[model samples]
Target: MLKGILEGCVLKVIFDNETYGYEISQKLQEHGFQGISEGTIYPLLLRMEKNGLIEATYKASVLGPRRKYFTITGKGKGELEDFLTVYKEMERAVHHLFAQRKPEADSEENTGFGEPEWEG
Candidate 1:
């Protein structure tokens, strides 16, 4: 599910500044990208490069080996903009569907996936 959406994820991360692969991976990990692995991240980077959505350049590190850094291209920015539309629509639809139910008092702590206290 997230495989096809990584372009958006990668672009979101780099929208702030240029970053190396390892840094990007660490950031994604911190953000709770559930299925993302280092193996999965690079290929998406390559594919994004192939599509001209992002550009990668290598730089020497002072304390370590050279690192490949990725930056979001104008095309990638435009693609992310497009994704925002789709993502917002999806979010709205999902929220609308789920918002119809009332949450149980104790369910605020549970997301209703594994250990649920909510009826929805």
Candidate 2:
């Protein structure tokens, strides 16, 4: 679930502007996606590049080596649209499901899955 969502998010970021992996990670963090390291971002970018959802080009930076920037392709925009549609449906369904729960259910200290909450 997260992989797919992350793909959409990466696509959206690239669609908004051509950017590199590190900048994408920073934008995600600024958007409330904390703790997502560049390690996680590079793999996703590689996969997106392989799938032709995005294309990368090396550009000379003011400091250090060249940076590989990403831009979304037409296919990627379509995928982002589809992802948004499906995400909205799922969000509504989850909200409705929780809203229908019995009021007594809220008093329990369970994990909300018919089991005790783990103390991890």
**Per-residue alpha-carbon lDDT of model 2 for 8-43, expressed as tens digits?**
898899999999999999999999998888898899
As a whole number from 0 to 100, the lDDT of residue 15 in candidate 1 is 78
* TM-score, every prediction: 0.76, 0.85
Q: RMSD for each model, in Å, please? A: 4.8, 3.5
Q: Residue 89 of candidate 2: its Cα lDDT? A: 95
Q: What is the lDDT of residue 72 in candidate 2?
A: 93
Candidate 2: C-alpha lDDT: 0.88
Judge candidate 1 at residue 42 and give its lDDT: 84
Q: Would you list the C-alpha lDDT of every candidate in the order shown?
A: 0.79, 0.88
> How would you encode candidate 1's per-residue C-alpha lDDT over 1-120 as one tens digit per residue?
456567687788987789977788888889987666778788888888999988889999999999888889898899999987888888899888765545553355444333454747
Name the 10 consecutive residues with the lowest summed lDDT in model 2: 108-117
